[model samples]
Target: MALHWKLVIDTSDAPTLADFWAAALGYEVEDQSTLIDRLLAAGQLDDSVVTEHRGRRTFRGFAAIRHPDDPFDRDTGVGQGRRVLFQDVPEPKTVKNRLHIDVHAGAEGLAALVERLESLGATRIREFDKGPAGHWWVMRDPEGNEFCAAQ
Candidate 1:
């Protein structure tokens, strides 16, 4: 069996990053508020670690988005696979990303998708048309993380 994993990204503001990615990928932001509420009620967790986000309680230091079709814990809303976790970091992104997400927007949708992303705060970096490799546009998320929108 293949090992399961979720890509984790560091961000200065986890919720904002999570929101952007959720819209970008048509994913759902995981909701762990029920668990948080249970833990808080049982005195197993402190309010210090939680914060209000989008009108719900969420972990202050992290947030996540997952493919809507993927399996997830019903009670906690934690994805079982195919997810991206965003964790808070004190330092900002200072260099190019060594690993980046490449969004596959079919040839017909590439332009529109790129424009939608730009409207969501992604900045266009450049575009390339590799004769055999295909066409793509480089972009940076609101927080400066680089990714590609490709055909």
Candidate 2:
């Protein structure tokens, strides 16, 4: 059987990064308000670990995004398919990422896709073109994490 997985990224601000990725990937920000509330009520969680975002209570220093069509636990709002989690960290990013996400332009075409990403706070680093191979751009997200935008 295939193993289940989700990408976990470290960020200075989890909610903001998660929002950026959700928009970039057309994914839904997972809403864990129900689980948070339940935990709080049962004394399993502390109020200090919660914060409000988008008018809902969520775990502080943690956020996640998931593919819209993926199955998820309704009670917990945890995705069972393609998902990415962002967690807060004290140290800032000091080097290039060992692994990075590659975003395809799909029906929008490469130029339009890059433009859209820029509007959403992505910065173009450089472009690559290999004669019969492919074309792509190296870009950084709002938090300075590198990723690829490809046709």
Candidate 3:
């Protein structure tokens, strides 16, 4: 059987980073407001651990984004398929990522794709080009995590 999984990234600000990735990847930010409200009503959650973003309550240290077409729990807004979760951490990122996301540019081509990503708060770090092999750009998200924009 195939195992389920989601990528988890550590950030200083979960909500902001989640928003940036959601836009960059064309994913939807998970809405956990209903679950938050329910938990609060049952006293299973404390108000201090919650914060409002985009007018909805969410956990202060966690935020997530999921593929728009994927199945998710309506009551909890947790994705059952492709997803990424951002979590707040006290330590700063001091080294390169051991793993990274590679975003391929489709019909729009690399230039347009890079432009769109930049508009969404991604910064181009460097470019790579191999004669017949490939061409791509290294980019950093708002939080300085590395990812590739490939052609």
Candidate 4:
């Protein structure tokens, strides 16, 4: 059986990172505030552990984005597939990423996509002109997470 999985990224600001990744990947930001609200009402969760994010009551230090077409729990809004979870971390990024995401934008569309990503707070790190493998741009997200965009 195939095990289910989701990528988890550490960030200083979970919600902001979620927003950035959601737009970058054309995914939808998961809204789990309803569950949090219910837990708060039942006294199972404290208000101190929740905060308003995008005008919704979400658990502090956690946010996620999922592919829009993926199945998600109706009540909790947790995606069943193709999800990325962002969690708050106290320390800033101090070294290069050991793993990174690669976006395939096709040869004709890469330039435009890279420009769009830059406008959304991605930084152009460098470019690799691989002959047969094609070209791709190395970029860092707002929080310094490295990812590649391929043409």
Off by over 4 Å in 4: 106-108
Q: Is candidate 2 or 4 superior in TM-score?
A: 2
Question: Which lDDT value does model 4 have at 145?
Answer: 98
lDDT of 2 by residue, 12-120 (tens): 9999999999999999999999999999999999999999998999999999999999999999999999999999999999999999999999988999999999999
lDDT of 1 by residue, 8-49 (tens): 999999999999999999999999999999999999998899
List per-candidate RMSD values in Å: 1.0, 0.6, 0.7, 1.1
lDDT of 1 at 4: 90
Worst 10 residues of 4 by lDDT: 102-111
Among the numbered candidates, top TM-score falls to 2
lDDT of 3 by residue, 30-146 (tens): 999999999999999999999999899999999999999999999999999999999999999999999999999999999998999999999999999986899999999998999
Residue-by-residue lDDT tens digits, candidate 4, 1-151: 9788999999999999899999998999999988897888899998898999778877899999999998999899899999999999999999999999998895549899899899999999999998897989999999999999998
RMSD of 4: 1.1
Candidate 1, residue 60: CA error in Å?
0.5
Query: How high is each candidate's TM-score?
Result: 0.97, 0.98, 0.98, 0.96
lDDT top scorer: 2
Q: How far in Å is the alpha carbon of 119 misplaced in model 4?
A: 1.0
Q: Arrange candidates by lDDT, highest first: which order? A: 2, 3, 1, 4
Which stretches in model 1 have alpha-carbon errors above 4 Å? none
